[model samples]
Target: MNSAVSFFYFLSFLTILSAVMVVVSRNPIHSVLYLILTFFTLSGHYILLNAQFLAAVNIIVYAGAIMVLFLFVIMFLNMKQDQEESKTNLTKIAATIVGGTVFVILFGAYRKTAIEPFNPQTYDSQIGMIESLGHMLFRDYLLPFELASILLLVAMVGAVLLGKREIGERHF
Candidate 1:
C-alpha cells in the first residue's frame, strides 16, 4: 500500500483507540486527556486529508483551548473517583440493545448511500488551504460563524455566572 494510505490507517486506529479510552476511562481527568488525544489524532487525519488549516484549527480549538477549559472545570469541581452503581440490570440491557440498534441502523444507512471513491490524483488540487477555506467561511458561512462566536460568548458568560457564589445578603 501507499505511504498515504498507511498513514491514514495508522491515524484512524489512533483516533478510534483514543475515543474508546475517553469513554472507558474511570477517572474524569483521564477521560478528558483521552479526548484530547482523540482530537489530536483527528487533527492528524485532517492533515493527511490535505486540510492543514483544519488540522491546525482542530488542535488549537479542540485540543488546546476546549480541553484546557474542560480541565479547569474538572479541577474546580474537585470530583472524587467513586464507584458508580448501575441503575439496574434491565436498564443496562435496554441501553445496550438501543445502542446496538442505532449503530446497525447508521451502518446500514451509510452502506446504502453511494459514496464517491477517493482518487489520489485529485490531491494535486489545493482544496483545503487556508485561503480557499477563508473564502468559503467568509462568503458562504459568515452568518453561522458569527452565530457560533455569539454562542461561545454566551456559554462563557453562563459558566461564570453558574460558578459565582453569592457572598452578601440579597438586596430588594
Candidate 2:
C-alpha cells in the first residue's frame, strides 16, 4: 500500500511489541524502558492522527517525566523480596477474567458508537493548537482545570508523605 499506511502499521507493531515486552520483561528497569518505547510509538500514532500537540505532550509527559519517575521508583524500591512471591493460579484467573470483561465492555461500547463524518465547513484547524487549548482551559473549562490542579497537588503531597519512611511501616 501507501508509505503512510505502511508507517502507521510499523508504528502500531512497535507499540504493541514494546507494550507486551513491558509486561513480560523480568527486570523492572527493562520493563520501564519498554514502556517508554511504547509511549514513543503511541506518540507516533498521535502524529499520524495530526494531533501534534497530543504527540508532543505524550512524548514529553509520558515518555519523558512519567517514565523517569517510574524508573526512579523501581530503582529505589529494590524489590527483591517481593519478586520471590509468584502469582497464585486464582489471582491469574481473576486477573484474566477482569481483563476480559473490561475488554468486552469497551469493545461493545465502541461498536455501538456513532461516528460523525468530518465536516470541513464547520471544522476549525486551530482546534488542537496551544492557543486554542489555553483559551479552552482558561475560559470554558476553568473550574474543572483548577479542580484537577488541586487534586494533583493533593496527590503530590500524598506521594511525598508515602515516600518518607514511617515507624513500624515497611517502605512507607
Candidate 3:
C-alpha cells in the first residue's frame, strides 16, 4: 500500500482508539485528554482532505476552546475532592514532544503531497474561503442555517430552565 493510505489508516486507528478511550476512561481528566486526542485526529483527517481551514478551526475551536470547557466542568465537579495523582514533569514533557512530532510528521506529509490544479471551467477559486462560506451559508443554505440557530437557541433555553434553582434553594 502507498504511504498515504498507510498514514490514513494510522490516523483512523488513532481517532477510533482515542474516541473509545474517551468513553471508557473512569477518570474525568483522562477522558478529556482522550477527547482532545480524538479532536486532533479529526483535524488530521480534514487536512488529508485538503481542508486546511477546517482543520485549523477544529484544532482551535474543538481541541482548544471546547476541551478547556470540558476541563473546566471536570475541575468544577471535582473541586471538593483532592487530586489523587499527578504525572511527573518528565512524563508531561515526553508527551508534549511526542505530540509535536506527530504534528510535524502530518504537516510534512501534507506539504509533500501534490495539489490538483484548479480548472476555472469546473472550479471556483473562492470555494473554501470565509467570504464564500458565509455567502453560501446565508444564500443557498439559509433555511438550514436558520433552523440550526433555532435549535441551538431552544437547547440553550432548555439548559437555562434545567439549571434554574428553586426560589428558596440555598446557594452554595
lDDT for each candidate structure: 0.89, 0.89, 0.88
Model 2 agreement with the true structure over 98-164: per-residue lDDT tens digits: 9899999999999999999999998887777778888999999999999999999999999999887
Window of ten residues with lowest summed lDDT in model 2? 79-88
Q: Kindly give the stretch of ten consecutive residues in candidate 1 with the minimal lDDT sum.
A: 78-87
Q: Model 1, range 1-172, lDDT digits (tens) per residue? A: 9999998998899889999998788788999999999998998988887899999999998888989999999989776666455547999899999989999999999999997787987655577999998988999999999999999999999999998777894756
Per-candidate clashes come to 0, 0, 0
lDDT string, candidate 3, 57-138, tens digits: 9899998898999899988887332563565788889989997999899999999999888776987655666677788899
**How does model 1 score by TM-score?**
0.75
Against the hidden true structure, what lDDT does model 1 obtain? 0.89
Q: What lDDT, from 0 to 1, does candidate 2 have? A: 0.89
Model 3 ranges off by over 4 Å: 79-132, 153-172
If ranked by TM-score, best first, what sequence of candidates would result?
2, 1, 3
Q: Is candidate 1 or candidate 3 better by TM-score?
A: 1
User: Highest TM-score, which number?
Assistant: 2
